[model samples]
Target: MTKKTRYGVKFYSVCTTDDYGLNLQIYSGKSDEAEGLSKIQTLVHSLMEPFLDSGHNVFMDNFYNSVDLSGKLLKRKMHTTGTLRQNHKKNPTAITQAKLKKGQHLSKRSKNVYISNWKDKLEVLAVYH
Candidate 1:
Protein backbone atom coordinates (compact mmCIF):
# COMPACT_ATOMS: atom_id res chain seq x y z
CA MET A 1 0.00 0.00 0.00
CA THR A 2 1.19 3.52 -0.78
CA LYS A 3 0.88 6.30 1.78
CA LYS A 4 -0.21 9.80 0.78
CA THR A 5 1.19 12.90 2.39
CA ARG A 6 1.49 16.48 1.21
CA TYR A 7 5.08 16.86 2.41
CA GLY A 8 6.94 13.93 0.94
CA VAL A 9 7.84 12.31 -2.35
CA LYS A 10 4.78 10.09 -2.47
CA PHE A 11 2.45 9.04 -5.23
CA TYR A 12 -1.12 10.32 -5.37
CA SER A 13 -3.49 8.14 -7.27
CA VAL A 14 -7.08 7.95 -8.45
CA CYS A 15 -8.69 4.60 -9.06
CA THR A 16 -11.79 2.95 -10.48
CA THR A 17 -13.21 -0.26 -9.14
CA ASP A 18 -15.53 -2.87 -10.63
CA ASP A 19 -16.22 -6.57 -10.23
CA TYR A 20 -12.67 -7.49 -11.07
CA GLY A 21 -10.51 -5.12 -9.02
CA LEU A 22 -9.16 -1.62 -8.77
CA ASN A 23 -7.57 0.00 -11.79
CA LEU A 24 -5.08 2.80 -11.17
CA GLN A 25 -4.76 5.32 -13.96
CA ILE A 26 -2.95 8.33 -12.54
CA TYR A 27 0.03 8.74 -10.26
CA SER A 28 2.20 11.73 -9.49
CA GLY A 29 4.70 12.77 -6.86
CA LYS A 30 3.93 15.61 -4.53
CA SER A 31 6.70 17.93 -3.36
CA ASP A 32 5.32 20.47 -0.95
CA GLU A 33 2.77 20.48 1.80
CA ALA A 34 1.78 24.12 1.40
CA GLU A 35 1.08 23.63 -2.28
CA GLY A 36 -0.93 20.47 -1.76
CA LEU A 37 -4.35 21.82 -2.64
CA SER A 38 -3.28 23.66 -5.76
CA LYS A 39 -1.31 20.64 -6.91
CA ILE A 40 -4.21 18.31 -6.34
CA GLN A 41 -6.56 20.75 -8.02
CA THR A 42 -4.33 20.88 -11.06
CA LEU A 43 -4.12 17.11 -11.21
CA VAL A 44 -7.83 16.70 -10.77
CA HIS A 45 -8.57 19.31 -13.36
CA SER A 46 -6.28 17.71 -15.86
CA LEU A 47 -7.14 14.05 -15.30
CA MET A 48 -10.59 14.07 -13.77
CA GLU A 49 -11.91 17.06 -15.61
CA PRO A 50 -14.05 14.90 -17.84
CA PHE A 51 -15.74 13.20 -14.93
CA LEU A 52 -16.03 16.38 -12.90
CA ASP A 53 -17.29 18.39 -15.86
CA SER A 54 -20.06 15.83 -16.17
CA GLY A 55 -21.56 17.17 -12.92
CA HIS A 56 -20.72 14.30 -10.62
CA ASN A 57 -20.94 14.95 -6.90
CA VAL A 58 -17.53 15.02 -5.25
CA PHE A 59 -17.23 13.88 -1.66
CA MET A 60 -14.33 15.01 0.47
CA ASP A 61 -13.23 14.78 4.06
CA ASN A 62 -12.63 17.69 6.40
CA PHE A 63 -8.94 17.83 5.53
CA TYR A 64 -9.89 19.05 2.06
CA ASN A 65 -12.84 21.11 3.30
CA SER A 66 -12.75 24.88 3.10
CA VAL A 67 -15.09 27.61 1.90
CA ASP A 68 -12.66 28.84 -0.75
CA LEU A 69 -12.06 25.35 -2.13
CA SER A 70 -15.74 24.58 -2.00
CA GLY A 71 -16.53 27.77 -3.86
CA LYS A 72 -14.07 26.84 -6.58
CA LEU A 73 -15.67 23.42 -7.03
CA LEU A 74 -19.12 24.96 -7.06
CA LYS A 75 -18.00 27.39 -9.72
CA ARG A 76 -17.32 24.39 -11.93
CA LYS A 77 -20.98 23.41 -11.45
CA MET A 78 -20.05 20.38 -9.37
CA HIS A 79 -22.13 19.58 -6.30
CA THR A 80 -20.21 19.16 -3.02
CA THR A 81 -21.25 17.07 -0.06
CA GLY A 82 -18.75 16.70 2.73
CA THR A 83 -18.42 16.48 6.49
CA LEU A 84 -17.68 19.94 7.75
CA ARG A 85 -15.65 20.48 10.88
CA GLN A 86 -17.65 20.75 14.09
CA ASN A 87 -16.24 24.21 14.79
CA HIS A 88 -17.31 25.38 11.36
CA LYS A 89 -18.87 28.82 11.49
CA LYS A 90 -22.61 29.32 11.19
CA ASN A 91 -24.19 31.44 8.50
CA PRO A 92 -24.96 35.01 9.60
CA THR A 93 -28.35 34.96 7.89
CA ALA A 94 -29.31 31.92 9.94
CA ILE A 95 -28.76 33.72 13.22
CA THR A 96 -31.94 34.90 14.96
CA GLN A 97 -30.58 37.16 17.69
CA ALA A 98 -32.47 40.12 16.31
CA LYS A 99 -35.83 38.33 16.57
CA LEU A 100 -35.38 37.42 20.23
CA LYS A 101 -37.67 39.27 22.65
CA LYS A 102 -35.67 39.63 25.89
CA GLY A 103 -36.18 36.19 27.47
CA GLN A 104 -37.73 34.09 24.80
CA HIS A 105 -37.43 30.34 24.74
CA LEU A 106 -34.24 29.39 22.92
CA SER A 107 -33.50 25.97 21.56
CA LYS A 108 -29.96 24.63 21.51
CA ARG A 109 -29.98 24.63 17.75
CA SER A 110 -30.99 28.27 17.61
CA LYS A 111 -27.82 29.50 19.28
CA ASN A 112 -25.42 31.55 17.21
CA VAL A 113 -22.49 29.41 16.16
CA TYR A 114 -19.40 31.26 15.15
CA ILE A 115 -15.83 30.54 14.18
CA SER A 116 -13.22 33.24 14.76
CA ASN A 117 -11.35 32.59 11.55
CA TRP A 118 -14.34 32.11 9.30
CA LYS A 119 -15.65 35.34 7.81
CA ASP A 120 -19.07 34.19 6.62
CA LYS A 121 -21.53 31.92 8.37
CA LEU A 122 -22.30 28.44 7.10
CA GLU A 123 -25.60 26.67 6.95
CA VAL A 124 -25.53 23.50 8.98
CA LEU A 125 -27.48 20.55 7.65
CA ALA A 126 -28.03 17.55 9.90
CA VAL A 127 -28.64 14.10 8.53
CA TYR A 128 -29.74 11.22 10.73
CA HIS A 129 -28.97 7.71 9.66
Candidate 2:
Protein backbone atom coordinates (compact mmCIF):
# COMPACT_ATOMS: atom_id res chain seq x y z
CA MET A 1 0.00 0.00 0.00
CA THR A 2 2.98 2.30 0.51
CA LYS A 3 4.34 1.80 -2.99
CA LYS A 4 2.91 2.89 -6.36
CA THR A 5 3.49 -0.47 -8.00
CA ARG A 6 0.64 -2.89 -8.48
CA TYR A 7 1.08 -6.44 -9.75
CA GLY A 8 -1.43 -8.93 -11.03
CA VAL A 9 -1.89 -11.46 -13.83
CA LYS A 10 -1.07 -10.22 -17.33
CA PHE A 11 -3.28 -10.92 -20.30
CA TYR A 12 -2.83 -10.30 -24.04
CA SER A 13 -5.84 -9.08 -25.87
CA VAL A 14 -6.82 -7.87 -29.33
CA CYS A 15 -9.68 -5.44 -29.30
CA THR A 16 -11.42 -2.85 -31.41
CA THR A 17 -13.38 0.26 -30.54
CA ASP A 18 -16.70 -1.47 -31.19
CA ASP A 19 -15.91 -4.55 -29.11
CA TYR A 20 -13.95 -4.91 -25.92
CA GLY A 21 -12.16 -8.01 -27.16
CA LEU A 22 -12.11 -9.72 -30.48
CA ASN A 23 -9.56 -12.16 -29.12
CA LEU A 24 -7.72 -12.73 -25.87
CA GLN A 25 -4.99 -14.96 -24.51
CA ILE A 26 -3.87 -15.35 -20.92
CA TYR A 27 -0.19 -15.46 -20.08
CA SER A 28 0.24 -18.66 -18.16
CA GLY A 29 3.90 -18.89 -17.36
CA LYS A 30 5.83 -20.58 -20.17
CA SER A 31 4.20 -21.47 -23.44
CA ASP A 32 5.49 -23.75 -26.18
CA GLU A 33 7.53 -21.86 -28.74
CA ALA A 34 6.40 -22.15 -32.31
CA GLU A 35 8.77 -23.21 -35.07
CA GLY A 36 10.86 -20.27 -36.33
CA LEU A 37 9.25 -18.00 -33.78
CA SER A 38 9.97 -16.97 -30.21
CA LYS A 39 7.44 -17.11 -27.37
CA ILE A 40 6.45 -13.49 -27.85
CA GLN A 41 6.20 -13.85 -31.60
CA THR A 42 4.06 -16.93 -31.15
CA LEU A 43 1.84 -15.06 -28.79
CA VAL A 44 1.17 -12.29 -31.28
CA HIS A 45 0.69 -14.74 -34.08
CA SER A 46 -1.84 -16.76 -32.16
CA LEU A 47 -3.84 -13.70 -31.21
CA MET A 48 -3.75 -12.40 -34.77
CA GLU A 49 -4.20 -15.73 -36.53
CA PRO A 50 -7.65 -14.95 -37.81
CA PHE A 51 -6.58 -11.55 -39.03
CA LEU A 52 -3.59 -12.55 -41.13
CA ASP A 53 -3.24 -12.49 -44.94
CA SER A 54 -5.60 -9.56 -45.17
CA GLY A 55 -3.26 -6.60 -45.37
CA HIS A 56 -3.59 -5.29 -41.86
CA ASN A 57 -1.26 -2.82 -40.21
CA VAL A 58 -0.15 -3.62 -36.69
CA PHE A 59 1.02 -0.91 -34.39
CA MET A 60 2.82 -2.10 -31.29
CA ASP A 61 5.22 -0.88 -28.67
CA ASN A 62 8.67 -2.14 -27.75
CA PHE A 63 7.44 -4.98 -25.55
CA TYR A 64 5.96 -6.83 -28.54
CA ASN A 65 8.25 -5.63 -31.29
CA SER A 66 11.24 -7.37 -32.83
CA VAL A 67 13.08 -7.36 -36.13
CA ASP A 68 12.41 -10.99 -36.87
CA LEU A 69 8.75 -10.72 -36.01
CA SER A 70 8.34 -7.71 -38.26
CA GLY A 71 9.88 -9.57 -41.19
CA LYS A 72 7.73 -12.62 -40.59
CA LEU A 73 4.58 -10.58 -40.42
CA LEU A 74 5.45 -8.90 -43.71
CA LYS A 75 5.37 -12.24 -45.46
CA ARG A 76 1.89 -12.84 -44.15
CA LYS A 77 0.58 -9.59 -45.65
CA MET A 78 0.63 -7.85 -42.29
CA HIS A 79 2.68 -4.69 -41.97
CA THR A 80 4.12 -3.60 -38.64
CA THR A 81 5.35 -0.30 -37.31
CA GLY A 82 6.66 -0.30 -33.77
CA THR A 83 9.34 0.74 -31.36
CA LEU A 84 12.05 -1.83 -30.91
CA ARG A 85 13.28 -3.11 -27.58
CA GLN A 86 16.73 -1.66 -27.05
CA ASN A 87 18.24 -4.92 -25.85
CA HIS A 88 16.63 -7.17 -28.40
CA LYS A 89 19.40 -9.29 -29.95
CA LYS A 90 17.88 -9.15 -33.41
CA ASN A 91 18.05 -5.35 -33.58
CA PRO A 92 20.70 -4.04 -35.95
CA THR A 93 23.58 -3.00 -33.75
CA ALA A 94 24.94 -0.55 -36.28
CA ILE A 95 21.71 1.44 -36.28
CA THR A 96 20.95 1.15 -32.56
CA GLN A 97 24.51 1.75 -31.40
CA ALA A 98 25.00 4.91 -33.41
CA LYS A 99 25.33 7.97 -31.20
CA LEU A 100 22.81 10.72 -31.66
CA LYS A 101 22.31 14.09 -30.08
CA LYS A 102 18.90 15.15 -28.85
CA GLY A 103 16.47 15.72 -31.74
CA GLN A 104 18.84 13.92 -34.07
CA HIS A 105 17.98 10.69 -35.85
CA LEU A 106 19.74 7.81 -37.60
CA SER A 107 18.27 5.35 -40.04
CA LYS A 108 19.37 2.34 -42.04
CA ARG A 109 17.83 -0.33 -44.19
CA SER A 110 18.60 -3.84 -45.31
CA LYS A 111 16.51 -5.51 -47.96
CA ASN A 112 12.96 -4.55 -47.06
CA VAL A 113 13.62 -3.64 -43.44
CA TYR A 114 14.07 -0.02 -42.45
CA ILE A 115 15.15 0.98 -38.94
CA SER A 116 15.11 4.50 -37.59
CA ASN A 117 16.62 5.45 -34.26
CA TRP A 118 15.79 8.78 -32.73
CA LYS A 119 17.30 10.59 -29.78
CA ASP A 120 15.01 12.34 -27.35
CA LYS A 121 15.40 11.93 -23.59
CA LEU A 122 16.66 8.51 -24.69
CA GLU A 123 17.29 6.66 -27.91
CA VAL A 124 14.09 5.12 -29.25
CA LEU A 125 14.39 2.70 -32.16
CA ALA A 126 11.47 2.41 -34.54
CA VAL A 127 11.30 -0.17 -37.28
CA TYR A 128 9.06 -0.74 -40.27
CA HIS A 129 11.00 -3.78 -41.22
Candidate 3:
Protein backbone atom coordinates (compact mmCIF):
# COMPACT_ATOMS: atom_id res chain seq x y z
CA MET A 1 0.00 0.00 0.00
CA THR A 2 3.02 2.23 -0.30
CA LYS A 3 5.23 3.41 -3.14
CA LYS A 4 8.39 5.45 -3.21
CA THR A 5 9.53 8.26 -5.48
CA ARG A 6 12.87 8.77 -7.12
CA TYR A 7 13.31 12.51 -6.73
CA GLY A 8 12.44 13.42 -3.18
CA VAL A 9 12.34 9.75 -2.33
CA LYS A 10 8.86 10.19 -1.03
CA PHE A 11 6.38 7.47 -0.19
CA TYR A 12 2.62 7.47 -0.60
CA SER A 13 -0.32 5.21 0.02
CA VAL A 14 -4.07 5.36 -0.61
CA CYS A 15 -6.26 5.24 2.45
CA THR A 16 -9.98 4.77 2.26
CA THR A 17 -12.33 7.42 3.58
CA ASP A 18 -14.47 4.91 5.35
CA ASP A 19 -13.32 2.80 8.24
CA TYR A 20 -12.37 -0.02 5.94
CA GLY A 21 -8.86 -1.12 5.12
CA LEU A 22 -6.59 1.00 3.01
CA ASN A 23 -7.17 1.32 -0.72
CA LEU A 24 -5.16 -1.13 -2.78
CA GLN A 25 -3.68 1.34 -5.19
CA ILE A 26 -0.31 2.53 -4.00
CA TYR A 27 1.03 5.49 -5.91
CA SER A 28 4.51 6.82 -5.49
CA GLY A 29 5.20 10.35 -6.47
CA LYS A 30 6.16 10.58 -10.14
CA SER A 31 9.72 10.02 -11.15
CA ASP A 32 12.06 12.94 -11.12
CA GLU A 33 11.71 13.57 -14.83
CA ALA A 34 7.96 13.52 -14.98
CA GLU A 35 6.14 16.84 -15.31
CA GLY A 36 3.73 17.77 -12.54
CA LEU A 37 0.41 17.46 -14.35
CA SER A 38 1.55 14.56 -16.49
CA LYS A 39 2.54 12.66 -13.41
CA ILE A 40 -0.89 13.14 -11.90
CA GLN A 41 -2.59 12.12 -15.15
CA THR A 42 -0.52 8.98 -15.42
CA LEU A 43 -1.26 7.88 -11.91
CA VAL A 44 -4.97 8.57 -12.24
CA HIS A 45 -5.23 6.72 -15.54
CA SER A 46 -3.55 3.69 -14.13
CA LEU A 47 -5.68 3.62 -11.03
CA MET A 48 -8.99 4.63 -12.57
CA GLU A 49 -9.01 2.91 -15.96
CA PRO A 50 -11.99 0.69 -15.26
CA PHE A 51 -13.96 3.52 -13.72
CA LEU A 52 -13.40 6.03 -16.49
CA ASP A 53 -16.39 6.82 -18.71
CA SER A 54 -18.65 5.36 -16.04
CA GLY A 55 -20.13 8.69 -14.92
CA HIS A 56 -18.50 8.62 -11.56
CA ASN A 57 -17.24 11.62 -9.64
CA VAL A 58 -13.72 11.46 -8.25
CA PHE A 59 -12.99 13.60 -5.24
CA MET A 60 -9.41 14.43 -4.49
CA ASP A 61 -7.20 16.78 -2.55
CA ASN A 62 -4.72 19.30 -3.87
CA PHE A 63 -2.08 16.69 -4.48
CA TYR A 64 -4.24 15.02 -7.11
CA ASN A 65 -6.23 17.87 -8.61
CA SER A 66 -5.26 20.21 -11.43
CA VAL A 67 -6.86 22.05 -14.33
CA ASP A 68 -5.35 19.72 -16.92
CA LEU A 69 -6.33 16.61 -15.00
CA SER A 70 -9.88 17.83 -14.47
CA GLY A 71 -10.41 18.50 -18.18
CA LYS A 72 -8.97 15.15 -19.11
CA LEU A 73 -11.21 13.31 -16.68
CA LEU A 74 -14.26 15.17 -17.95
CA LYS A 75 -13.50 14.12 -21.53
CA ARG A 76 -13.51 10.54 -20.35
CA LYS A 77 -16.96 11.12 -18.88
CA MET A 78 -15.83 11.23 -15.30
CA HIS A 79 -16.30 14.26 -13.10
CA THR A 80 -13.80 15.58 -10.59
CA THR A 81 -14.22 17.80 -7.56
CA GLY A 82 -11.41 18.86 -5.33
CA THR A 83 -8.98 21.44 -4.11
CA LEU A 84 -6.31 22.57 -6.54
CA ARG A 85 -2.90 24.08 -6.13
CA GLN A 86 -2.79 27.63 -7.34
CA ASN A 87 0.27 27.24 -9.54
CA HIS A 88 -1.16 24.40 -11.59
CA LYS A 89 -1.07 24.95 -15.32
CA LYS A 90 -3.96 26.95 -16.75
CA ASN A 91 -5.36 27.52 -13.24
CA PRO A 92 -6.52 31.10 -12.87
CA THR A 93 -4.10 33.51 -11.33
CA ALA A 94 -6.55 36.10 -10.08
CA ILE A 95 -7.61 34.29 -6.93
CA THR A 96 -4.43 32.53 -5.97
CA GLN A 97 -3.44 35.35 -3.72
CA ALA A 98 -6.68 37.30 -3.50
CA LYS A 99 -7.81 38.11 -0.02
CA LEU A 100 -11.41 37.32 0.75
CA LYS A 101 -13.48 38.13 3.80
CA LYS A 102 -15.21 35.53 5.93
CA GLY A 103 -17.93 34.64 3.46
CA GLN A 104 -16.52 35.93 0.20
CA HIS A 105 -15.85 33.60 -2.70
CA LEU A 106 -14.74 33.84 -6.32
CA SER A 107 -15.85 31.56 -9.10
CA LYS A 108 -15.29 30.94 -12.80
CA ARG A 109 -16.58 28.37 -15.21
CA SER A 110 -15.54 26.76 -18.46
CA LYS A 111 -17.48 24.70 -20.98
CA ASN A 112 -17.58 21.68 -18.70
CA VAL A 113 -16.01 22.80 -15.47
CA TYR A 114 -16.19 25.32 -12.67
CA ILE A 115 -13.56 26.70 -10.32
CA SER A 116 -14.14 28.54 -7.10
CA ASN A 117 -12.12 30.09 -4.34
CA TRP A 118 -13.37 30.56 -0.83
CA LYS A 119 -11.74 32.30 2.09
CA ASP A 120 -11.98 31.11 5.62
CA LYS A 121 -9.00 31.02 7.92
CA LEU A 122 -7.10 30.59 4.67
CA GLU A 123 -7.87 30.57 0.96
CA VAL A 124 -9.29 27.40 -0.58
CA LEU A 125 -9.62 26.80 -4.30
CA ALA A 126 -12.01 24.15 -5.53
CA VAL A 127 -12.56 22.78 -9.01
CA TYR A 128 -15.41 20.69 -10.35
CA HIS A 129 -16.18 19.38 -13.83
- How high is each candidate's TM-score? 0.40, 0.86, 0.73
- Which candidate achieves the best TM-score against the true structure? 2
Candidate closer to the true structure by TM-score (higher is better), 1 or 2: 2
lDDT for 14 (candidate 2): 83
Model 2 C-alpha lDDT per residue in residues 4-123, reported as the tens digit of each score = 888689889987656578788888889899998988899999999998999988888899988888889989998989899878988889988888999998898855778899999998
lDDT of 2 at 3: 75
Better of 1 and 3 by TM-score: 3
Question: Against the unseen true structure, what C-alpha lDDT does each candidate score?
Answer: 0.42, 0.87, 0.76
Positional deviation of 47 in candidate 1, in angstroms? Answer: 4.9
Instruction: Assess the local accuracy of residue 101 in candidate 1 as a C-alpha lDDT between 0 and 100.
Output: 43
Candidate closer to the true structure by lDDT (higher is better), 1 or 3? 3
Least lDDT summed over 10 consecutive residues: which range in candidate 2? 14-23
Give stretches of model 2 more than 4 Å off. Answer: 1-7, 17-19
The order of the candidates by TM-score, greatest first, is 2, 3, 1
List the candidates ranked by lDDT, beginning with the highest.
2, 3, 1
Lowest summed lDDT across 10 adjacent residues in model 1 is found at 110-119
Candidate 3 residue lDDT tens string, 50-109: 778999877889988887788888999988999989888678777666778988999888
